[model samples]
Target: MDNWNILLESTNDGFTIATVLEVPDCQIRDETKEGAVEKVQQLLQKRLDKAEIIKIPTPIQPSTLENPVMRFAGIFRDDPDFIEIMKEIRAEREQDSDL
Candidate 1:
């Protein structure tokens, strides 16, 4: 039995959707997260029983601070006074939210 990675996302409509990363066509949705997962498992088993071919997904590369994209993502923190800046921003947002 091949192990596959499943992605679960919660919807605003109060449903959980499950998708098998390796098999794009294999998706299931249910009211609860567990139900969605159970359905996907059964769906996968059925496909396997039918002799369908499914490829195992390649593992995702680990993100590192050394990567340019990752390094650039934190550009806002390059400011020497980032901690104070964030505190002020949060305080302003909280004040606005309370209005």
Candidate 2:
């Protein structure tokens, strides 16, 4: 059996919005949270009735621990000039590009 996690949010207009965690674009809105969840489940069932689920195995890759560049992740964390440098970089990026 598959379980779907539903997230509920209350709106200012006295309505509830429901979204399924595992399903993309599976959102429902109703007067009650339970009603939205139920409606989304029904819609998922309708889709499942006409589709098939398949799994594709991906090839295993080498571990990142052996990579030489992995040690520089936080190389500039202690640099006091990093923030000013980053600000200058961001200001440059915001300007019009010549390309």
Candidate 3:
């Protein structure tokens, strides 16, 4: 079984809207919060039943500059100007530090 995070919001018109965070397409509305959740679950189940196979990608952790793993996430080996761009950035930083 897959776990899904559901978001609920109450509208000005007195309807509760439920949205599945993992599956943006799954959304439902009801007069009560409980009903909205039940509807969303049914909708999600239908979606699962219709699909032959479902592939869920691993969720990425929130990254910061201090995270070593995330620091290298954007490095691209095939980019020809990558090294030159890094050099230019380094030079600019060095100039800033010198001032």
lDDT of 2 by residue, 1-99 (tens): 798898889999999988888786888899998899899898888878998999999876667446778778789988879978998988888784743
Computed on alpha carbons, the lDDT of every model, listed in order, comes to 0.89, 0.85, 0.91
Tell me, by TM-score, which candidate is best: 2
Flag clash pairs in model 1.
Answer: none
TM-score, each model? 0.51, 0.60, 0.53
Query: Residue by residue across 19-48, what tens digits does model 3's lDDT show?
Result: 999888899999999999999999999998
Candidate 1's C-alpha lDDT?
0.89
User: What tens-digit string does per-residue lDDT give for candidate 1 at 1-99?
Assistant: 568999999999999999999888999999999999999999988987888565998867665425666656777766869878899999999999999
* Candidates arranged by TM-score, highest first: 2, 3, 1
Worst 10 residues of 3 by lDDT: 59-68
- Colliding pairs, model 3: none
User: Which TM-score value belongs to model 1?
Assistant: 0.51
| Candidate 1 vs 3: which has more lDDT | 3
Q: What's model 1's lDDT at 83?
A: 74
Model 2 lDDT-worst window of ten: 59-68
Task: Please identify model 1 stretches exceeding 4 Å from their true place.
Answer: 52-99
